[model samples]
Structure formats: C-alpha cells, structure tokens
Target: MRALKLVGKTLNFEVESLGIIEWYIHAIISYQIINYEVLPADTKTPIEVIIDQLSSLSLSIDSKNLVSKNYFQKMKEDKLRKIYPYFLKMLNNPSLSLSLSLSLSLSSLQTIKIIIILDIQIFIKLMKYLKI
Candidate 1:
C-alpha cells in the first residue's frame, strides 16, 4: 500500500502525456502484484523495503564506458534500449494509432512544404515540371 501510494504520488498529474505515464504505471503495478501473489506469505516483503534494499545494492556502471563516449551518450543508449520494448507494445494499442496517424499526416505534408517553401529555386523548378 505504501509503495503504491508513493508511486501514485510521484505521477505528474499536470503532464500532458498521461496516457504514456499511465501505461508505465499500470505495467509496474501489475508486475509487482503478480510477483507478490506468487511469493509465499511468509516470504513476502513490502515494496518499499525491497526498493530500499535494491537501492543499497546499486552498482555504478564502469567509468571507462563514460570517459570516452560521455555519460549522456551511454545514458541515452540505455534509455532507448529499456523503452524500445515498451514502445513496441504501445504500437500494438489501437487508440495510439489514431494519434500517430494524425501526427504523421501533418508531419509528412509539413516536411514537403518546408522543403519547397525554404528553397524558392526548387519550388520554381517543381512548378516547371508541372508546367504551372
């Protein structure tokens, strides 16, 4: 209960991307509930206590990976790897397609118009191709 409340409180209610956030939250909660149910009652542990233990056991990745490539580069790669599976899962959700389709329509048109508008010579050449 305490862990659940903590997770709930950490959620940014004002953020515009609630659907993505909720997807992660529900995924985490489901994982926790399923694991807890499988564990024997005598062996069960509070989520906070488990988290605290894990925090204490945290190990830093090798500094060599950071020095040559920079920390942000490694961190970015790690974040992409972690989220890639979840992103694929989200792609399977039907409602998400609607938002993606709407975004793609504007993006594709905007990209073409930008290239034409930004290059007047190119626009004129294209018009000649059309005999306009």
Candidate 2:
C-alpha cells in the first residue's frame, strides 16, 4: 500500500497525454484504492471518503454481502467503471503507477488488444484534464 502511495505521487505530475501504460496503472491503483478493505465506513474512513469522491459509493460492505470474491469484483466494476475515464482520473493524474509497470515489464507472452483505434491528434487531447 505504501508503494502504491509513492507511484500515485509520481504519476501525479502533469502530462499532456497518456498511453496504454497509464490505463493499466490507473486500473491497478484505482482497483486497489477502491477494493482495499478498511473500516466499516460508518466513521467515514479515508478509503471510503476517497471512494465516495471517486464513484459516489458509500462502500460499506457488510458480512451478508460477502458471498464471494467474484461478487465483490463484479460490484467493484460498476463502481470502478463510473470512476475511470480510460483510467481513474486519480487526483487528476490517471497515469502509470509502479506495480503496473513491473507487471508489464515482467511479462512478455501476454497477448494485447487495443480496442480504441483513436486518431493520433485526438488521443493526446483526451486524457489530460487540465485547466491550461
């Protein structure tokens, strides 16, 4: 989790355009951020606060809802989908974190599919949510 904080901080730097790498990073970090188990949220835990801010979810999962891990993943997807704009716009970053880089670098045989066949000029302008 601490490592995630560092990567998150590093990715926070301003970048005009993001690539597939950034998508993987944000997906992983946002996944961890959204799904990391913490307080019950009655006290409004930091994770819950972040989640609520991200996807407007209360994120107070009870024992009754703990049917299976897939259930959580499925539910998380709905919330995660709401949050990620190609990658969760994590504090305005939406870019690569370390763990994701490690995974991509460590693996070679993974088959890839890029569904978004975007025009070059429009791609750079899409991910950066900047005032300038």
Candidate 1, superposed: residue stretches over 4 Å from native = 1-75, 96-132
The superposed Cα distance between candidate 1 and the true structure at residue 17, in angstroms, equals 22
What is the TM-score of each predicted model, taking all chains together?
A: 0.19, 0.20
**Which candidate achieves the best lDDT against the true structure?**
2
C-alpha lDDT values of all predictions: 0.32, 0.36
Name the lDDT of candidate 2.
Answer: 0.36
Model 1: per-residue Cα lDDT over 109-131, one tens digit each? 45222210113443345345434
Clashing pairs in 1: none
Model 1 per-residue lDDT at 39: 23
TM-score of model number 2: 0.20
